[model samples]
Target chain A: MREQSRGPAFMRILYLEDNPLLAFHVEQMIEDLGYVSAGSLSSFAELKEKFQSLQFDAVLVDIDLVDGPTGPDAAAWLQKRGIPAIFVTGQAQVAARHHDISLGFIEKPISPSDFAEKVELFRSRSTGS
Target chain B: MPIVILLDRASKPELVRAELARSWPRARLIFYQRPVTAVELVSGVQSALLVRLRQRDVRDHIGQEMELRRELNHRVKNILASVTSIFEMTRRGATSLDAFTDDFRGRLRALEKVHSAVFHAAEGAVSIGDIATLTFEPYRLVGQERISFSGPLMNLGRESGTTLALCLHELTTNAIKYGALSQPEGRVTLRWSVIDGVQPELALEWKESEGPLVIEPARAGYGTRYVRSALAAVFGRLPTIAFEPDGLRCSAQGPLSRLSATDSSQPR
Candidate 1:
């Protein structure tokens, strides 16, 4: 659980992605969209271990991570900590069941425009403006 | 009302008659003794039961087929997503259209080779040895054997195999551009072994030598970072990459259970 936002003024997005190439691509995309990448972790266990030190305004989670299908549970855990999470996965039906915990879903084969629009939700929700 | 009553040969027929009379006072009852050839009756019942069983079997097969189709769809989508990611990353780094095209094509070929191997594999899984051979075969000089790999017969599940193949591709491309494979005299060796213990571990090493002097890059590139993250995802541990003056060495070890295709995947 995060105590307080130690993140910089700009939004720092983190990715919970097991696929290395995809993780790198998303990191670059975050920078391309003018945001800083906190980092990428492969598993929910790794996320839990590294949560404290990581500085990110929001997290993009994939359903099937290095660990099993723990994305929904991770999102629920993040919600409890008051952190925002959005699922980016091919398994939309599975993600649909856990919409209660997540902000929304970004289907796989991610379009840059779609990604940008969904990611904007996090900023708007956080700022509360 | 018409009623029919069947009784075993040994049954006391009077008792059943009286009971049926009490139950249906106005009915005309017909009584017949059990057939002496009981085998026909038993076989008829057995055939009826088997018909039901066959229907259930067909239903189960259909269910399994649907599940397999669903799984295949997920796999294809994931591969497409990986391709999308590769395209974006390659484009980001490319200085020109030619560079991007070459790099992206190389990566796609590597992906296709692995998928082919996995498709031909008996259980939709592949071995590290198979991956290494497929990845290096195209890059090998016609007359010279510059790349070599040897390991035990260990299989990787589909996802793990795909990741490893991609990592090997990145390594191969880099070696060709600047590492050992760049020079005619340079050599690369990949070796792996299983460390038997309470929990057996798979240990692997990739070393390049006899090439130009090695210098650590100021910042890690796509290949290095991809290898680190991909290996970590499969092995559940980070791999070490060292750029010694003589050559580059990448090494990793993790629980064999995690790497084995036969074992049910358990999240660590």
Candidate 2:
């Protein structure tokens, strides 16, 4: 969370998406909204090995990934790493189970307004204190 | 009412009447002294017995028809649910109106193809090998040697069969678009074998070669995503897809308890 609190504070977002097309589309969406895509990964096992190297202020996770239902675990992993995360997924009920760990969720076929609002919310969260 | 017991000409009437009355104690027995002809029997009380038996037969037939109707209704509901799920999931990844239409229709066709295979199957389960054949049939028509699959005679449950069919459809679609089957010299091999342990597992491997060199893309495609979800949902495990410099390779394994009734999914 404090990564963006530093000098020039770019909102670098690491996305946990297994679908390359969706990942590419969402990466474009993130960049179009004036945020940097730190990188994208397909599974939790990959995230576990590489989270330290990726330079990102926050993470955008989907509830289901290539490695089964491990998005909740990813969110919890980010939380423990002192980073904030948000779920961008179609499985509302399953994501809600781990909503406490993530700051919020942005649903699939992501609405631009919702995407902007969530990003603002995440940024404001870092500046508040 | 006196219950009459007809005695053949060879039998004495008094003795038969006594025996019948002893057995059917609540009814009075009246034994006839002479044997009746078939014509006489049809016109007598036996006609009433024949009518009752016919009525019972009609009732049994009706019961069987009702049972068949209920089963057909249940199967129709299952098909509807399965189609709806496939449509909903496929709709999520489509890029344009045309893309969505084509993708959705293709997926439905895949489901329809698998349904026909299942219908013609002699046993309750469909063989995995048949599903692979149906999925790659279009490519095979072009060049028989271009694509080949070999697997054990593993049978899958109806739902699992549908899931596997859809997964194979995605893989075949990808191979046609960008993988090994995209060129004349390219080829794909899909092979599987059951591994025995505390639990038997079905291992599937899809390998491609002899085409353009492959590279991992910046993002995954719809086919990859569908295969992952369908496999995970059906097999309770995720497939490993590696984009090697030479070609693409994918492998996954899960317990046989998912589809087979017993461990008979493995080769004998």
Instruction: State how far residue B2 of model 2 sits from its true place (Å).
Output: 16
Q: Assess candidate 1 and give its TM-score to the true structure.
A: 0.77
For DockQ, the strongest prediction is 1
Q: lDDT winner among the candidates?
A: 1
- For candidate 2, write residues A1-129 as lDDT tens digits: 555455323778888875443554566567767778765776787788776667888889977665566889988988988889899876567677787899888876566688788866667666764
Question: Candidate 2: which docking quality band?
Answer: incorrect
How many clashing pairs per prediction, in order? 0, 3
| Candidate 1 residue-wise lDDT, B205-259, digit = tens | 8899998999999978778877887787677678999997888999888888767
Which portions of model 1 miss their true places by more than 4 Å?
A: A1-12, A34-38, A41-57, A66-68, B1-55, B261-268
lDDT of 2 by residue, B215-254 (tens): 7888877688667656754565667888987888988888
**TM-score of the second chain, cand. 1:** 0.76
iRMSD, per candidate, in listed order: 2.8, 10.5
